[model samples]
Target: MEKSYQAAQAFSGDLSFLQEPADAVAIRHQVLILHCLAEGQQPISISWYKNGEPLPPSSYIQQLLNGSLWIRNFQKRQRNGTDEGEYSCAAQNRYGRLLSRKARVQLAYLSRFHRNPQPMAVAEGSVARFQCLTTAVPKATIIWERNRTELVTADPRFTLLPDGILQISGVTKDDVGVYRCLATNPANSRYSDEAWLTLTGSAHLSHQEPVILSGPQNLTLTVHQTAILECIATGNPRPIVSWSRLDGRSIGVEGIQVLGNGNLMISDVSVKHSGVYVCAANRPGTRVRRTAQGMLLVQAPPEFIAWPQSATYAPGDNASFSCVVEGVPQPTLAWLKNGKYVEVRENTRLSDNNRTLTILRVTYSDEALYQCIAENSAGTNQASARLAISLPQDAPKLPEKVIAFPITSTAIQVAWNRPSPADTDGIIGYVLHIRRAEDPSTQETQEALSKMTFKHKLMNLEPSTKYALFLRVYSPVGISRDSGTIFVTTRDIVPKTPDFSVTTVNDTSIRIDWEGAPPSSTIQGYKLEYRKMPCTSFQGTQILPRNQTSFIYYDLEPSSLYQIRLVAFGNSGDGNDTHRFVSLRRSGKVVPDPSPDSEEEHKPTLGLIFGVCVGLACPVLCLLLLFLLYWKRHLCKRKTNEGCGHNVQEEKTDQAIEEERDRNSEEPTELLSVNPTNVAEADSSLGRDATRVKEDQSHEPPHPAV
Candidate 1:
């Protein structure tokens, strides 16, 4: 890097253009110091020779256009002046010292004894220009600074005048501070006392309406080109302004344009322009500026980032759609089948909020690209996202809706349909997941049926409870999303005691059957109960497991109506539902034998005919007996029928028996008369017969009907 350059004074000695210092050198450092006359009135080769050399390196030369030169930054170690020879500086390369040009010094102000610094004023919210007017013995250099920092004109918003005026755009509260002017000559350097500018108002420029604040807003700027984002803000007593990126110190151009207009005039606009930016503006006399941010959104095609939020579901199921997009306006969701719209009957719907599509009863055909569109008043954008519907890669439907009766403590059996609408590839298998309500929420889906459907019976549950049984069905999904939730319920019922009535009772045991109420919980199996004929404690009470409804007690007490109770057990709870009294009858009472004479006299007319037909019925009776022996099952059935068939016959026989008893209730009195003559003879025999009559009466048979 060449640090030195041959110089020519193209303008006044106001080194203002070089806002900051370059390498300012002095006389002691200069190897060439020629105080002699030019020896001629010619524009000499104003070049610098270093280390006593005739010419500085050809590389150490630069033409300062519209620029000036007058050095005064000199101390004991360095020198700077224009005495026709104060323009040289020396440099030492490995080769030795080199001398710069002495004639490079140009003094055009030999006639001026003094110069005044430039003066300017601007409102707090407006632009300002300051002119530097100063003096020196010969030609002098001038510079401007605010708060010790040099100012520049390369700034697009801050331009410089040909005379020596500093132009500042969007003057702010910070700009109200005092400014300093300096003048340097070959003799010495002098600084004018600081000039304090009393600014009354803010310098923040603000647009009234349809304008962006702080940073650019409502941009009507051209597209594709760098846009200068300008904020139009209005605050009482305008403010100072500066531009910056949302996260950085400054934005827009550099050096000459770092802080200007409280805006960043971009060079090229691309898709990246869509973002937020910040700017600082302060009211007059305030150190803290009001900062604001604006967004830069570029119009472009919509980038669709969407998927089926709920992908895995049963054949007859519904799922929600998730759509993400980037564009001017928010996107609208649509269900696209083969790149087209779906009909209303398909049960597919778009959500009112966020426009997410929903598919009910999802099927294989529901797989396709769903287009989302984002459009602004200017144009429209579209994006495509693929949606897939698949079966659960888990177990099949289980016996669901099973719940234990809380009071009965009985379990219920639950079952349900399995997942449908699986991929044509076929289901791998299924597995059943059985758990309590307090179990972990997460469970894996499988492809094995043996594991899927479960004959789950809930236990340790409350009785008299209508419990809920949950079950699900699942299938394989090659590249399918996971199923959300499968749910179903077992039949709910109230708990009741088991009907443990005695079917048969023996001296030791009793055979019993349960006819109790239905169970509430999922009933996977059953149990039997028994006890001693008179039991006071559970120690004597016995319970046996009977897969069937009926159970036999072998050691039951005979002839006792045992106090017994039956209860159904389930997951929910237990309850006593059935009760029975069992006892055996004994045959020990007396009965009289019917007399033969009584049978003859008491027989009804039908009985007389039956007696007469007995001989004739013998063959028929034998035939019937033979038939019954051959077909025992039929005879059993007929025997049951005989009871119903003889109802009317029994009623007629009862009526006949009633009538015969009524007729015999009273007997007629006999008269003791006979013929006169026979009477005398009868009298003599009667006396003798009387004695025998008493003896005969004791042994005589019952008389026949008259």
Candidate 2:
């Protein structure tokens, strides 16, 4: 146990050592050493290694007494590549071992250049490289220099390689210079021999004009055929040639190809290719350019581009027609009407190189079929159109005299002559218009008839009424203007007898009164007549206008019976008569005259009687007295009787009755002063007859007195 404790103490102290020496360098034939120190209780061993490997005993390498490594001579040729490496010394004790820090031993010698840079020749815009090779004891770094100035690697145009190579790209005339490469290390630095660079090509312009070897000429070809145009040029360095159209359009290689010798070739040529073409030649690095022009022609036939179209215009309006044609040779145009050549008229004109025709102030006569004819050396073609004129329509003329007649009491027949043909285009039908004269809106009628018919019958009209009528004609175009209006009336019907009463009666006069007829009857006047009872006709008649409702008759015979009648007249004629009978008589007592004895007291004496006898003896005086008395009494009675006998004729119109009255003398009859009592009795008797007449009419059919 004492020996084991002693061994442990020894091992702990054995690992202690002294510091080693740093790295070192040496020249050829120079001496070197690597050394370390260690202390321990047991014996310590030491070893030497190079680059982590054991070093064997060699003639130039030896170990010293203090455990250090030694190199006697550093010879590069005899070292066999092992002279340059890391060297280390290791020491150990009974418990542990320790390695000293490594130290490097490098061999050094002066540089020896093997090859010098050679002279170089390159064209402008080419690449150049300079080379320098050398041998030395240590590795060396290479550098480039141009024109005695050091060059940096940052320059893009010049680059320096690790093996002493200098390169320059895109060499220009400015880059022509002398260049050198330097080899350098810690021992010494050496430079290669200088070299010169030469550039062969030129980059300057020359003053010379370009020349054309082959020429440019005009070309003509048919449609859809191939065509070729040639152009060539010569210069110091052959000139570049190109083809272009004069209209400034690019020519493609699909249909039009440009050859290397400046020639243009076209396949399937068309009318669009017919234009001037230009060829240009230019030399690089010189102001030498030349140009030439050539024309291309293509043949084609006539083709119609636009044809004539139909047109319509009114009178006094302007019209125009145009036709367009395209051909190699221009086409000629002409105008024709109705299949014949149209000559220039007063208002006709032509313009636009005879391709258009114009008409001014057109008329109805100008309406016709028009044709446009186009002709050329190739062929001829034509187109036609119709031109029409429009006119206004006119109204028909008035018809001839119109007449209307009564067909019945409530209907009428109307007739007229047809209108003249000159005033109408053509009548298709006629129109008859009828309306009531009093109130047009009350009743209206319209009828349409064929063109041949000229009369119409109006029916279903009110009796005793008037109507207004007019006519109109119609055609396919429009209706004609209204004709003159005329008035027509329907026939009037007979009226019932009027009821009359006797107002007064006298010895020779009677007074009677009656009521007016109905308003619808259209009564114009009234008539009254009377005669003795049982007489075949009336002895006297009175004509009264429509305004009078009462009448009186005088100079009637006393104590006599008479018959009376009253009638009403209208637009048609006299209506049925109302009859009556009456008697006239004296109703009062008569008075007597005084006797001659009462007149004797108021008479003259005997002398007056004697005077009267003497006056009577004169015959002329007695004859005149008797003749006067006889004429007054006898002639007046005879005239009165004749007037009463012919009074029936008074029923005539007032105009005829007035003429008869003018022929008679203006004298009063003897019976003009009859008694009022006798007149009143006669009127009363006449009233009874009127009542009987009305009763008789109610039981029988009415008879109108014409």
Candidate 3:
């Protein structure tokens, strides 16, 4: 335990006394020691004091190595001075010093008897008493002796009170004696004059009520000090004394003691001990009593429970500083700036008791070191803090690594990295600027963005158009520089309308089937619109989900020409419309529909009719020539032998040619056909037939252009 205590004390830097001096008495010429031990940081020194002043250097007195004062030769009073007085010591280190509790030191001695025992003659079978008193450094103990020998009062009738009063009840001839009082202490002893006690005629003792000789008086002291309340009483049978709080509180015995016949003493008093104390003296075994009361007031030094802290804030912001202290008496507080008294103005205000100081719309001039001073009857204390005003130079930096991209044909998403918290301490929000690239005549639009979100989407923008974007961060003081510009363009061709075919399902309904394309993120849905021809206005437009590729229209009018339009829609807007014309027949027969692109072309004219006529006549003429050639060939086969059978080699060649024709006829052949819509198709067909005939004559010699 001792080692642990020493270890703790060695590291503790605050001055604390391990031992303090206490009240003591010394014999004349005897050695005296006043203890004053403390622990703190290294390099500690000790000093002694006497009677509220520094002790002068002397050979008779000196401080010991353990921070104690030693008086080699103590004296009660000398020609020059006395060694008896209030003495205290202090221990000092680099941190601070602490003074030990003051102790009263006095020399012990017994003085001559101030009042001797008076000779008394008491009646037999009655009460008789004798008294003795003296002055001593410590309250001396009194002893009674008869005939110069120690008196033994073993009889029930004999009694000795603490105040040196000897009482004898039922006194007979045996109680007669010559008595003397003695006062003794550790220092010395003294004897009082002797007197004779004799028996006389019958005597009567009167009963007296309890009467308070001295009562407690009002007093005030600081906390942790001692308090004494005096209460003395006298009565025929000696009153019994007790103490209590006038407010009915218990006088706790922790630091309480009864001193000298009935006085109350309390040690280490605190604020809770401050109250009116009641002292009562009651006659033995009776209700009769006498009471006295006095008030005690405890005060404490000013100590801070809260202190102001240094802070930095942007200009035009309200700043507050607070200081709170506690004490027995409410302390008065004052404000200071830079070690000087603070001047109050329209912008500056102080709370009740000057505990809080507030500055409104603080500017550069309001920045300074601030202090709060608190004072009371016990002691004074002060605390300090600093206020700083932020300037434009301290504004947040521009956003880093800004980027932008298109989310759809008309929407663009922008994002950027946030600056570090230390650099953007006072930033409130961000501002984004957007405008068409290379178009100074266009108005730039600005959007205010929340500081918490680093990404923002710009909607309702023109498709296939480029935009320039930049960012700026702002604080209460000012805004930062603009970040580097970034460019992004919205997509134009995405979510294109899919081609669809319309077919009659019934007399009143038509079903549409469309080719599906790969899914795109920008595609939202599809819109279908249809209208009767010649009206030029669509009716009953319907929106379908993005994944749907087919739709059925019901309750359509029969025998009517209707135009249908389908388009894909997304965040940007609807894409190009696909238009088709459908004709419904009233007879319930569905006609084959022409290609959607052919519906826009004009009908054939007179030139197309003439070309069609020539094309029809040429085919008929070819058939007629083919029939005539066949008949002529039959006749020639019969008449050819007589006139043409002259050369044998010629006949053989003709037979070979017939054989060649027969072999060619075994192969299949194809004939050309045409449905001429214009003169160009008819001419194209005639040119193709001529080219084929020329190719057939390639085996013969080349013919001239006739």
Candidate 4:
């Protein structure tokens, strides 16, 4: 029983403690607990070990009732690096012993000395960095400070690193100061030595000489013009400016003035002020001086060289007038008509510096008094002329609303109103001229008795033809230009049949070509009709524009004959149709029809006959099979009845035999009472007779009657 118990308590898995101390911790603040388990059996003793040896009892360590070893206030015990090592616990019983895996424990401490922060010198707009290094068991949080005050790392210019490094970006003069770093943790806190930052660059100071930013340049001015000169300068301290003439003359005298910002102004300048001027800039307590100069000029005004003269001209004639001028500075010249400024137009032109005014195709409206004017800065001049027109007579104007009406198929009546009084000269008679616009050879002329009569009949004109007509008035003066041309047309006549030909024909469409109707015919459109051959009436008709010389008819029957007709229509009526016969066949080739016998042979007769015969014979065949099955079943039943009859007969025979034997045995009993001796002999004879009868019955066949 002891051995069995010992086997049950054997260790089965790796031995390890349930709870172990952290790998590293601050001294005097750490505690370690080692809980060990021995499967199946309680340990007889549990103890703690350090460095592979039994640990001596001390105020810092103890064992608990639950097989756990506890350590408190762990500290460094040796100076040769023996203070940190593995710790373990052992549990033992009567069966076996187990030692738990080693758990390491280390005593932690703060660094002994803090490193000094590095001093840095950087140019403005440059980055500066300071470092603080130290040795510690646990990583410390780093803090940056400047001038004894903590700095917020959220500022974009300052950065604090975890390893006690401080960075200042874009360092300016204001960033120069004392910097310090602080490192802290749960064990303790320490600060590094202070560091100083210095900045040096041009951004810290400003020093420059005066620079001329803008100044006046050489210039020229006309007489009686305003002049202005400007000079601008820049320096560390603002500079003062003064203006004077280079010829030792004081400015701001005799209409000359000085403006703020070193600009000189001269009003209504004259020839005396036409000289170089100087501008000077100076700074207080500085010996440096700057200067700029500008020049001026005065010019004379214009004067006339020759005066213009008046002139006369007839209507429709070209005329011109001349004037000339001269001055120190060229002057601008202009022309005025009747005291109003003359503007250049299609009929008027100005040339020779506006010294000459020309009129192109002069009319009554252009007759007026004209003047020439010249001007300059100093003075002005003028000249004048008169224009006129000379004429014998003016052309008669065209009448309004000329109209024409059809009088006959080849004639038209034209009428109009008299010309306006202002345009008509004394007239005696009028002449009418008419001609076909399309054929100028066909023309006619007629004379009327008086110009007052404004009606005439144009005779012998072509039907459906456009004509150009005009009327003119005549007197002692040459006949007036013909009035505006008027176009007129006689009533239309029936169009002639158009000449056409079949261009293309196909199974489904037919294309025809034709020459368009003559221009004189005035045909509006064409009417096309088609029908199958031998048909009386035509199918639907299509109307085509007069310009359409070709048309295609669609949806025609294939392998069919057709008759097509084309007729031209005018305002009067449609002309006679030009007919043609056409056939719609494939590719213009006829395919012969198949023979009737072949068509019939290709029909599906065999499949139809076979299907019909199968449909009718299936029920007859099924009835025959049913009759055969019934006959077979009937024969089987008849045979079964015959077998049963035979079995019944044999059974009846066996029953009879049993009855006969029973009767015989009863007879023997009766004989025993009659005579004992005679009974024995009688019984023997009866037995023999019974055996003989049985053998005969066995040998005999069944009776058919039974």
Candidate 5:
């Protein structure tokens, strides 16, 4: 059984997370736990992170075996450390890694009200309102108290908003008493400043429209600072003042409050708070109001979110650096080299809003420290990275185990394994050195090859010829020393005929069947040529895959003779051809010629099958007999050498041994003794007996060598 393992499955269920940390609010000095559990490949490790950085191990903060973070005596504020900010966890294994959702950890505490309930005088039977707002994490709950007693909020006459505002309708004399806000949270509870609510008789009170005594003025401040917009108003029965953004954005209650009757105070202001503010003063129970407006501009200095990373590259390669900054008004970006501005040209340019700098076809002189500067109205910032140029001194190692095979009479296939990964770093491509055995090195032809290619074919060469070949590996720096030379002899141009039989399938179709060749990568496909008999010119050709051995030729003239040819092809070129002539009658009956020259065509289908079987088995028997003869001869030579005390033996190099092994595995010994240079003796007894089948087609004799 195979062992099962899974990497970080990302969102897949294999590496499922049972629980993840969530936003939490804990009281100071209390223990807090954040959960992160995952299941995946064995030997998985879990790590905790805080504020986007790894959290250092400490006694105060510990990670449990189950991948949960436990904080002891969690501190909201400390001189050295604080238990706050965002927290996340990661589960990792050798296969992959995954990160969990980020969770914010905040101390739970409610601050004293920036603005407490103030004394107000109003007429009885009119609506009355009171406001109490405080800053708190996880939000604080506020309850109204009448004379130290919890007010009945269940009464329909009272309404409470999420922001700690209280409203009362049909105020009676019973409402006249000391009123305050009691705020409670996970940390502690406190009461706001007490204020007495007084009411006069409706008839005795004089009504007046609300009026703004002062309006907030425009203010500007930097980030992480505070801004105050003052708005004071007065009216009979007192008016209620509220704040809003002119752009219709929320006047968020966090770090924001109304102080001293109607003043707006914002703490820890950021660029997001830069907007126009509108303050409205309205009389209680009526829409009569006055308004004031102010603009608060918050500015921030340029800060980098993405920086260029250092890298190394060879000459003629492209190099690029990117720098990204975020600030108010979207900071402008610029590029510099070694503290000086870089000249912009066609080869060196900026893109993507001037945030990216690209140097095309970088040369050695282009190597330098690249800097990116961003400037805005607020401030400027810069970051830099170094670009190092490398000119390798060592070329790539030579190709491994180079060997060549005779693919055809005029073509040879050369293949080699790539060098080990460690020796291939700077490799750009390969070069083949080809020459005849008797030729000078200066006369050798060089063929360039792609770095990724491992096998190549050398075509259009002389048959029955000897050639010497070697390989050279090239890199950006230089070329490697030539590999050991290997010699290969091309085969004589003698193509073997395919044994096939043609049978009529219909009035216009006849199927040709042949035995398939043994599986070999070199066998590319097969070609089928057919036409009417005695025409010399073929009509058309059809190519079939190497695995296919049968084809049907259709749309032939009825009662007409047709000649069909089938031949196998390899990477080199076409092989021998088998031709057969068939005649179809008007009744769709097929007939074969019975001429003495075409005896095999007159055989039945069974006889054709037997012939094919015998033909294939003959090659195997011949190969076995040749191996036996070679082995006997080798044994006899060894015995004779031992008997004569002749221990002389030739030493073979690693390259020579590999070449010998490849040659024995790929090539078969030819039986004929014919020499390429002596064509006059080609018809000798040895050639006639060695095995060359005679083709006796009626109109065409056997094809001789070209």
Candidate 6:
């Protein structure tokens, strides 16, 4: 255990004695000496410490033998409040060695004061007077102070009457705080009890600057909404603040009601309030000074003009919505479902009412109208936008036989004649979202519709690539319902019709393509088909999944001029059908003219010709015959001639023939005239002719044997 200091050093003398702490409450003490016993040695000195600080850096109590040397009185110590503890008395010899033990005195708050003053209260708007009314047994004299400064000592604002009355005339609120009175007599003076003075009067400015302020720096209100306005100001004497409407109207309570503060205020401010507002401050001391300039802007509420005004959000799905609002006070956005704040991961959930609100990993409970409110010192503005959470009533069911254009395939044009009746909130838009069909993440994209129409034409699809598509409807009342899927494939041909009627139908179908090509779009094929009126099964629908211009209706009855029209389908299942009327584009036939060389006499019997005939006994014939035809003819003729003239020619021919034959044969076959060692040498090579079969008798497999 650490032991505290007992008594640093003690003052003692054999001539007399001093009693220990005799008074428990009264801490002042004195050492009484009946006789002076100290002579040869020396008198002792007393030192004090309020928790280790010398009582006085200069004065130390001395045990003087004469009356001048004697310590007639002693006092306690003080800290921030006058009274501090830990006093020690020390005694030492001139030899700077031997001394007596020490004595300690503990003092508190006001200390063992020579005197203390009492209360002196005064009325508002009146001259204030305070005096140090204190009495020490030795009859202490009086002095005054305010803050830490000596009141009557030097301050011109303060004066002391010979009668000891400390007075300040016509005192304003500036003199309202705590003040202290000090009574001085000789070595020590007691402080009067701390007294406070408050003056009642008009407002006064305490702080400097033309501070500009608005209602509340922090507020949430709806966009394009109305709200109140105000500002912040500080001063003494309580300056009066008033808020005024731009349209001219006085604000705040008046007279007997104490107009309280004079900050101007306006109710229901809209875009009209988006301007500079001046806050006027007036006080008795500080004249009328208005705020430099403060601006108030009224913004609009969350009226969603974003990617998705309404959508179906599934559990653990991402739902992003945005809104732009305007109001006097800027708005704040908070996402709530069924009326409660959402707590998602920091990044996944966000509120930037200034622009948009995003919610990731959205759940069913997150379906509700999110309110983005803007508020200011005046009032609150609010706006609400709705969201929904739902899954398709059921997965899509592939449509029945769809008669699309030959250019359009792998798809069908569908407008749900029948959809799930469970759609209560009505559908907001249809989602033609398609995943990799192999991935697990349910990513999605939604195409919103302008109306509640059952028909929607989708385009740009990969042939034979299956997709999972669902529709979700929304109503202002119930935004959480998603309709079941109505699976409709896209036409193989790029469908370009805004909407159409099929006409001009016959055994062979034909239709004019009118819908413009899709932006940067490509198509693969088209499908064509037709069934008799009221047929049970599209009797037979021709799926011409290619870009076939016209298709013959093979399924129609023979000799039956059936009504038929073509519908073009692209690879992505988007298609457009020709008018229902079967209008055949009478195809023009061409007749070739007779050659001028007159091989076959002109059989003008019936036909007249208009097309030019292209003939080529050379260019044309070249395409008709192969190089092998010349080889066969030359090969047979070479054997018939052997004269030197014939031989020379035959030799050239034969040489050419031999060279050709040699070129055709591989080294292995030519090796019949060489040594076996040479054959072995050729076989060892890694060249194509060696490693692979030699370029000879390419038709026949080569053998190692010569």
lDDT tens digits by residue: candidate 2, 342-441:
7888899988987888888876457555667665554445555556554345544555677777776788898888666554338888888776554312
Best-to-worst TM-score order: 5, 3, 2, 4, 1, 6
For model 6, what is the alpha-carbon lDDT of residue 511? 30
Candidate 5, residues 123-160, lDDT tens digits: the string is: 77555677788998767889899899999988876766
TM-score of 3: 0.34
User: In order, what lDDT does every prediction score?
Assistant: 0.39, 0.61, 0.67, 0.58, 0.67, 0.37
Supply the global lDDT for candidate 1.
Answer: 0.39
The digit string of per-residue lDDT tens for model 1 on 1-706 reads 1111112222121111112112232442233223311111111112233222332222223323221233232223223322333233222111111122223332323223234444446556555555555544443566777777786646575644322345565666666666776667665666655666656644553432222232445553223545555544335454556655565633444322333444455655655555677766766665645666676665543455553331334455665555666544544444544223555565777666545777676665464434444444333334333344434445333333433322223444434444344421254443343332211122322223443443444454433332222233334533233222222233234235443334443344445555423332333223233222232211122222223465554543344333334544333223333334444323211112212123344346435445655767776765665555447645554554343322111222323433432332221111011001111342233223322211111122222211
Give model 6 RMSD, 1 decimal: 41.1
**Model 6 off-target regions past 4 Å?**
1-259, 267-269, 282-292, 302-706
Clashes (backbone N, CA, C under 3 Å), per candidate, total 120, 8, 0, 1, 0, 112
Top model number, TM-score: 5
lDDT of 4 at 281: 78
The residue ranges of model 1 lying beyond 4 angstroms of the native Cα positions read: 1-217, 220-227, 230-263, 266-301, 308-321, 326-328, 352-356, 362-369, 374-706
lDDT of 6 by residue, 175-227 (tens): 66677766554336566577777655543324444333323222333334333
Per-prediction TM-score to the true structure, in the order listed: 0.20, 0.26, 0.34, 0.25, 0.35, 0.18
Candidate 3 residues 1-706, lDDT tens each? 0110111123334445677787789988889998888775555566777876778667688788887889899987777689888886655443323455557788998878888998988656555667787888877888889888877878766666555667665678877889998889877898889999897764454787877766788978788888877676666676888998988888788999876557788899988898999989999999999999999998887789998766666767888889999988988888876434667889999997799999888775575657777867765566666666554766667688888899876899998887787765677889998876523235679999888778999999997786777788878867765675576788664556777766666656666667665643444555666655444235545556566677777777767655666766544445555655566664433223332223233234334544665777776765565566557655654453232321212212323433332333211121011111122332233323322211111123222221
Question: Between prediction 2 and prediction 3, which has the larger TM-score?
Answer: 3
Query: Worst lDDT window (10 residues) for model 1?
Result: 667-676
